[model samples]
Structure formats: structure tokens, C-alpha cells
Target: MQNKAIDFKRQVNIKLADTKLQDALSRLQTRFVEGRSAVISEIHHLEDTRTAAAAIRDCVLNDLDSWLQKFEQQAIAHGAIVHWAETATDANRIVTEIAAQHNVLTAVKSKSMVSEECGLNDALEHAGIKVMETDLGEYILQLAHEAPSHIVAPVVHKNKEEISDLFAEKHQMSRKTGIAELCLEAREILRPAFLNADMGISGANFLIAETGSVLIVTNEGNGRLVTTLPRVHVAITGIEKVVPTLEDVTTLLRLLPRSATGQSITNYVSVLTGNKDAKAHDGPEHFHIILLDNGRSSLIGGEMQEMLRCIRCGACMNHCPVYQNIGGHAYGWVYPGPMGSILTPLLSGLKSSPDLPNASTFCGACAAVCPVKIPLPDLLRNLRTRQMALGLKSRQEVLMLKVWGWLTLHPRIYALATKIGVRILAMMGGERHLLHTLPGATGWTDGRDFPAPSGKTFREMYRKKSTK
Candidate 1:
């Protein structure tokens, strides 16, 4: 597999320079931020619910094996087939096997990060099955041949004009302006795909073990169509998505929308029990639930287990300074933002994505706003420590950290080194008060301006204050 992190950064840099993309990003930020803030302000009990939700997740993670088995039993009893996948490859193989057995020619997909993780579309395509993404954001990205830029809003990186152009080229339609027109254009094309698709795949927002229901919350109706319209429905989700009951799911639901896009509830929250029963009018004949482990089993007893509590709200990404600047693709995986920083390395391994865990500013925004109260910043720090222990950090960075560690053990040298570093930066910048180019500071200055450090060190200031 290619290193998506590197490519994501390169793509972001290119996108950031484009005026249209910048405008679209700015508008998207304003819309989501304000909307979410308003929703949060309206809900006085949101924080309390978040606490409850966190506790629920804590309990689930603690007894994951039991909960998973219970979930499987309940789902199977309801006429759903539950398949366990220990790895991404296993998950893909399971989905492919099902499709092949059904003689599926085309599959319609709702937005599912688990599917993205398994590279499901690629696998299906390689197997000679056409897969179409039905979500508006995902559909745009599919047309553009790009990965999702946001967990919820996958095509947040593309501007209206770019989307218009992409649609025009792909479908041979005339370019149009305005959101409604663009949406209509997309609807015109995707409606047929939904009706004609052989199989439908989706990701569950929450899976209730008590009732054997898979809950899909969406602003658009695509998820419902995807799950019910096709002959076969496959729901792929992580093992951590399991909850004990609808009441537990309700607690999460209360916090999820407010923290995500700030809605009271998303427009659509469809609870699917199983395949279409004799009494049902419209629904899939076969319902397959693929529970993907993909390194989550190893994280169960570790400090990073808290990461699995994430509700995929995208609140963290919306509030994330790095995500707001570079967008989701930069994380180089299906998940992005503070959650992604921890998850990408854990799922993909630190060696495959050495830069991911270190991509954080550790601002605590993700943790503060998390609906399930996941300690994202702390988990990120833990991942960084693990990465360092594995010797995945750059040689220069490792040597610098070693020298710094040595200095810290010896206070006199630490003070001396700090003073010297300040003086050197001050001399290099002169009166500009900015170092445009510095050996170690290039990354900082690449996208944003970096201020030069003041000549006076904190130690020097502290010493003078004590003397005075």
C-alpha cells in the first residue's frame, strides 16, 4: 500500500493554494462550527449524556469479548449473518466472497469508514463488481477519484466549481452554479444507481446488541436506500461500535449530533433489525454484518482503548486546527483528526505511518468536544511514546531528543543549552523577528509563519525576577 499521508499532504498543499478550495473550506468551517455551537447551546444535558455515553463505552471495552459474542448471537437470531474479520484483508475477503456468491455485478455504498479502511471499493472493482458511493459527499469524491477529506463530509476539500466541473466531465452534463442545482445534478445520476444496484453496503453509527439493530444516522436518505433497496445488504463496522441496548445508543445519539454537526438529530436515523421479513415491503434479502477487528483487539487492554469510544462525529476534525488547515486526507487513512492520529498508527502500524501520531498539536480540542469523552490528546501522546520506543522517529529527531534528555538530567547544561538556542535564533532573525528558513524549523514555516524566539530565555527571566 502507498503511504497516503505523504500524498495527502502534497494534495492539501496544492488545494490550499487554490482560491476556490480555500473559500469552500472557509464556508464549510463557518457553517459546521456555528451550527454545532448552536445545537450544543440548546442542549443543557449534553455534557451529562456524554459522561453516560463514555461510561457505557468503558463498560463495553472492558468486557468486549462477551459483548461481541452477545451481539453476534442477537444479530444471528434476528436473521442477520455476523462475520468476524481479524484483519482488513479478512474483511475484504469476506465481503468479496459474499458478493461473488450472490453474483453481484454492482454495489451501492453509503458512507462507511470501515469499508474505506478495508479498501472495499477497490477490492470489489478488482473482482469485476462496480461499486458506487451514494452519499453526496462520498459520491463527489468517488467522481473526483479522491479519498474522503472528512469523516462525515468526505468532499469538504472540493469547491462547488470543482465539483461542478467533475460532474460535468464524468456525466457529460453542463456545468451549473448554486448548491441546489449541483445537488439535483448529482441526484439525477445517483438515483438510478441506487435502484439498480445488486448489493448495498453501509456502516453502522451504532449497533445495538440488545435489540439486534444496526443504526445508521444520516442527513441524506442515501443510507436508507442503500440498506433497503438492494437484494443484499452488508454492514461493515469496527468491533467497538457495539452497545448493549437502544437506551445506550440513545445516550450516545443525544451527544453525537450536537458534537458533530450540532443537529438535534440527524435527518435520518434508520434502525435495521435484519433481512426483509415476509411482512416487510422493501428491504434486503440478505443482511451480513462484518465486524472488523483490524488491530482493535490488541488495543483492548492498552491505554489506547479509549480511542474506540469515538462516535465518528467529526466534531474533532471540525475543531482541529491541523485538520482545518490540512483536511482529512493528510492523515493517510480512513479515519482523520485527533482520533485518526491515534487510530491510523494503531490500525496500520507505526512503521507504515510514522508521521501520523506526530501530526498533532495536542491542543485538547478533540478531547474537550468528544461526545464519548475519549482522551484523544493523551492517547496521541501514548502513541508518540510507542512510536519513539519502536525507533520510528527520524534519526535527527531521535538524536535531538536524546541530547535534550541528557541536558534535562543535568540542569546546568539544560539552562546553558536553552540560553544558547535563544541567542542563536535571535541572531539569525536579526530585527525581522522571524526565521523564514531554519534547519530544524522548516516544517513549521512551510505552511504558516513562524516567529523567532526572544533572546531572553525563561530561566533568565526567572533568575532576574528572583534577584529583584
Candidate 2:
């Protein structure tokens, strides 16, 4: 939320130098990437499903006002309260005020990225309310006082041994090496919080405007407990999460779990229509939904509107080469990877996160796997162009671009320049066939060696082949 993305490169270097991080990140490809590929391949019409899902999201965005109004009317009709928040501050204030009004002392929270975006935990704590993260990944982060590194896998950046140490230190329990043992230990500690909490806070996977229900999909049972066991329940999410109907929610559900965790469907999918009725056996007495704008309204009819279609499935980041090398924290905010590169700049301001757009390799791995088909590489490139227009780039970069542009305008000079440049690079490479870091230049070379040119222009090679 704070946007330390200004330290993007520094954070990247720190994460790269960390062997433990590298070891942990190595599994991301196998776990999320390959798993998604295998699971999605099972669908005979995955592309058609994706296109339809995208269309549903686009339909919502095209007439967001009418849909939101319909949603509000339907939700109130079902006896639920809906609140609009214009900014992060407004959102936080609304939640804390709700807690205060309910006389809530202890609150339990399920994993919600929008809450993180609004810095809700700190705000609630400052308001003198105790908060507990019920999701295992989020609970671990809460214990260690660390932020989530991945959207679905919040604690992906940490290893089991580190988590074991954290639990032992924080929970004052004996160290457990087995994953199951550790999970049970966490559950043991969190059970009391679930029973004692006066209010529950959660993130919505999809908001169905038709039935006025809040839907959440989870592998663990925490989501249900957090929303039902407490007397009061509050669901906070971006306005982009709304869909037109239950069928729309169902269409997106077909892709969310597969794209996120490679599951057929999450173990628990709960649809909360409203609070407890007079005849209902058990449920929260008061239910509220906070729709957060926080800079999303500006993208409705703009070049960046497609970004609003994201389902937070994280398929794009799972395949991102840059994120593979450096984990999400380097993006320096709640969202990370390809989507973070676009959304962080758009929401937080392009000036605050100048480096995020350029963090991509333009390889299109992200776009290929995107369930919604957001053209991520093109968006990142557009951000870079905006950087140029705003004069945010260094003079050296601008000068280099200008020189490169001028050279391409003169064919003979450009040809001669390439021929001479290749020979110089060849001489520098000598027998190694690779160029080491040039003096005073450790940009790319700092990480790895650059291959030297072949010392022959493409034109010369083509002419020789033609003669042959």
C-alpha cells in the first residue's frame, strides 16, 4: 500500500541474492504453472469459456453504473447494506466505524487483497480492535509481520522451516517439521479466534448483481467461518469484481480455480445472499458490502479498462519470467507480477512506480496464460511510452532512444554502424563468445553474461547466401 516500488531494482537485487528465496521460488513453476497447464488442458473449450468470461466482465465495465445500481437495489432487497468508498481512506474509515458501531473488540479476517490495498488491519488495530488472519497463508504472514508475496499463495516466498521457526516463536509452541503438524498447530491457535470474534471481514471472489449475493471460493473452511460464525460480517472488494448474474459468476468460476491453484473447483464455494432471517437456524445477523473505487473508476472507458477484467487468478504472474527470478515483494505492494506492473502504476500513479512497467521482458508468457486474455505485454509497453511522455526517464535513456531512432532513418549509416559495432563486440568477446560486464556498466551484465555478436551484418550474410 505504501509504494516502496521506487526501490524496485534494489528489492530485486536483494531477492536475487537470497538463496532461500531462490529455492522457494523454484517450485512456483512446477506447482502453479504446470498444474494449471495440466488442469486447463482437460477442458475441451477453454478458449471459448475464457472469451465468454471476458465478455461478461466487459459487459459489467461497459455499463458499470447501471450494474452497480442494480446490484445495490437487489442487495438491499435481500436485506443487505452496501457502502460506497471513494478512496482507501474512505474505505478504512467505513470499516472501522462499522466495527465501532457493533462494539466489536475482536475480528477475524479471511484472505482479502483489497483489505491489504486499503491497509485495513493497521487501521482496525489503531482503532483498538484485535484482528486475526484466518487463512493459513495469511495467518503465517500475520504472525511473521510480513506482507503476502503472491495473490493465491500468500506465503509462497517463505519455506516451511522459516514458518516453523515463526510459529514456535510467535505461538510459543514446539517446533513441528511436518506440514500437517504445523497446519494443525495453526488451526489450534485460530479456533478460539473464530469462536470469539465479534465481526468477520472477507474478500469477495464475485458479486452477483442478479441475486445480490457475495461469493467466495476457498480450499480451506476459514472463509465460511469468518463470514458466518461472527455476529457481523463485512465483505470488501473492488468495484470490478461485480458481474451481471449468477450465470456470469458460474462462467468465471470455471476458470478462476484452474488459473489460480489448478483445482477443478475449490473445496468450499459459499454464496452469502444476506444476513440471518427470522426462520434461519444460524448466520451472521448483520451483513455489509463495501465497494471500493480507489482509482478504478478512471479506467472505465480508457486504454486500461481491460485491466479491470482481472479475476485475481494469478495465472499471468505464475508464468512471468521476471517474477520467477524475483518474487512478488519486489513489486513493493499488495499486487505483484505482470498484473501488478500494470495495476500498481495505474492505481498508485505512474510516477510513484516508474520501474514496474519496465520490469517485464515483453516475452508474452503472461498474456498466453491469462484466463481473461489481457494483453499484458502491450499494456506494459504503453506504460513505458507514458513514462517517456512524462519526462520520467533519465536523459541518458532518452538520448539513446533518439540516437537509435535517427540511425534507422539513414540506411547506409545504420548498416555501417552495425557492421562496425559487431566487429568491436567480437574483438571484445575474443574466444569466449560472450561479453562480460562492460566497465562502469553492470545493468544486464550484473546478473548474467551477454552473448557477443557474430561479427557479420545480416545484409552481408543474406547477400552471400543469395550468391550461393
Candidate 3:
């Protein structure tokens, strides 16, 4: 498959030309932005709550090892098995081993981005374990054999008709079925999967070190069922998900759902504290928490350490203009948008995704909406610097930047160039006042209308005003 960083430019062009994808992404992102703004506006202490949340995350990250050990000890005390994996391969191996030990035939999973990052479903399937996605959005994606487009709404890119068709082809449902009917059909199908699942796997929104609890927030009841109904429950999450205390979890929870989906809280928030009583027969008899490092631990005490504070609320992506235009699939990875731009290159290596850092408009909307206030634009810039230092940038881009730098150092030449360029553009614009294309800048004008220049540079305008 053509992936991001490798075929990003082509993918972006494809997404931009796809009117349907553009329309769907625009509506979904607009709704999410408005919803987040409306709910956050009602919180009088929004800043304080976010600040507390950031501080709590920072504390855990600063001493992450200690907190993780504490969580492991407490979880063990509560009759849970805690496993640590330093890499994605290691994590997949651990889960497969556990499934093998239990001879797990089928496993049910809730929406866990970490598991997606690890490619857990394919791993389990390769090991002869049948995996079922229980979250409605994830279930839809699973059926379609697609990756999630958005963090909060996984199948946001899919329209109802498309989904109806998918269900019809995959589940023998009528193609003419409405959305409600489709949901009902999905529910009916997933209910049986939950009951027959040999094990349940989920992602943790937050790991409470004090209580050894795995906190999960979901709109569907699938999260609860996945954790409670199976013979075994497994949670795979990043080491950064750990927090200092329950109070901290409460503070972060206030900001997470509001920033993510514009709700004060998700419909269901389940806290699994190591199978309180395995013999009770009401919940899972076996509880396991897998902590995956996957390059995150290396970020500590580094320039990008603030990235560790992210709670994965996805507010950054919702408000990003670039993300709205190109959509997530163009990003070519498990994570997308601003967070993905930074994390993908950091995790996958700068050479693997040289274009990601340059994907943003650097408008700062992402940093502004971020719950923990990660400087996303700055992070992107940092990645760009890293890319340049490693000589990963194309020679043409480097030469262009060198020429631009030279021009900027000579003000007179720069002004002269700008004035000439504007007059040329203005002439090209003619009556339409729009340039259909620009020489050597086709990428900028390919899927957008470039506004005509005013025939005068900013310097000329300022000079005339000063003379007056």
C-alpha cells in the first residue's frame, strides 16, 4: 500500500480531488470544533482544570518509571498481571503468548489506538485467534477492512449509504437500510461476539497509579462489555497513559471528552481495577495490563517531552485546516493530523516521513486547542530542523530555501523581486483575478484557487503611505 511519508504528496492530491472525502471531512471537523468550543466555553475553570491535568501528566512523565512500577505493584496486589513491552513486536508477542496460554479461540476488542499502532488484530489473526471489534465505529472499520479516520469518530469518512452497502455485502443486510437500522444490525451482530469472546482487549484512557485502575471512556457500552464479560481482559496502552492519582484522572477527564467530542463526559466510563473479584463470575477472571514503550520513554527530558502530556483528545486534528482538506488516510498511518505529523516521524524515524513536518500551515490552532497545551507547530518545526540536519530534504527544496534566504538578506532585491512577481501575477490574473497555475508551484495551486496579487508588494504600499 502507498503509505504516508513515501507517497504523501500523491495521497494528498488524491484526497484533495475527492469531493466526497472533502465534504465529509469538512462537516465532521466543523461539528467537532464547534462542539468542543461550546462545551469548553461553559466551563468557568477550564484553564485551571487543564493546567492541573498538564501538571499531573508532567509529574508522571518526569518520574514515569517509578509511577509505572507503583502501578504494576498495585495491579499485582489486585490480582492482575502486568507486562511490559519495549517495542511493538514485543507487545504483539506478549498478547499472542497470553492468547496461546489460554487457547483463546476468539477475542473481542474495544477501540484502542495503541493496539492499532501495534497492529494487534493481524498479530492475533496470524496466531489463529479470531478478533472481533466491539466499538461501533471500530466494528464498522473492521467489517470494511479499513483504518480509522478520526480518533473520536473512526469511520467519519464513511457516509451512511456507503456503510449501508458495506453491511449489505458483508452481513446480508439490505442496502436500502437507514442509519438506525444499520446500527441495530451492527449491535445484533456484535452482541453475540461479546458473549462468545474468549478474551477482551481494550485501550486505557488513563492508568491510575494510586488505584492500579485502567480507565476507559467510550460512547458505546462496548467498553464495559469488553472488560467485564469475557473470561480474560487485556489492556494495551502506552507507558505515558499512567497518571499519579485518581484525582488527577478526574481533572483530566473533565477536559478529555469536552475537547474530543464536545461532551462533558462520554456516555460510558469504565474503570477496571484488576478484576476486583475473579471468583465473582460477573467480571473477567483474568486481568492483564500491557505497557508498551515503543519509543515514548526516549522522549523524556528531551525537547519533545511535552508530547508525552498528550491525552489523545484529538482536538488538534479537528481544528487543523490541513487535516480538514486532506483527511486522515492521506496521512498513511495509525495516527493522523497534527499529532500524527509529529509522532509518526518521531516513532517511524525522520527519514521515513520527511514530509510530515512540512504538512502544517503552522496556524497554532492545534496548540491552542490542545488540552495539555503541547506546542504542536513548534514540534513540527523541530522535526523539520531534524530532517534538514539529517539531509533528508530534497535538493530542490534545499536550493529554493537557499535562494529565498539570500534574497531576504538583500532587502532591495527582495522588494524588487516581490514587486515584479506581483505585477506578473496580476497580469496573469487578468479579469478573473485568479491564477489557474503557478510555475514551479503547481502543488500550491493544484487543488486550490490562488488569489491574484494586488500588483504591488507590501513594501510599496507601506512606502507610499509613509510618503503621504
Report the C-alpha lDDT of model 2 over 325-373, residue by residue, as the tens digit: 9999999999999999999999999998989999998999999888888
Instruction: Return the clash pairs for model 2, or none.
Output: none
- lDDT of every predicted structure (CA atoms): 0.85, 0.92, 0.89
Candidate with top lDDT is 2
Task: List model 1 lDDT by residue over 303-343, tens digit each.
Answer: 78888888889998888887777777667778888888777
Which should have the higher lDDT, number 1 or number 3?
3
For model 1, what is the alpha-carbon lDDT of residue 302?
80
Ordered from best to worst TM-score, the candidate numbers read 2, 3, 1
Candidate 2 vs 3: which has more TM-score = 2
- In candidate 3, position 50 carries an lDDT of 74
Q: Give one clash count per candidate, in the order shown.
A: 0, 0, 0
Please provide, for model 3 over 395-432, each residue's C-alpha lDDT reduced to its tens digit, 9 standing for 90 to 100.
Answer: 99999999999999999899889989999999999898
- Of candidates 3 and 1, the better by TM-score: 3
The model with the greatest TM-score is 2
TM-score of each: 0.93, 0.99, 0.96
Candidate 1 segments whose C-alpha is farther than 4 A from its true place? 1-3, 6-19, 445-454
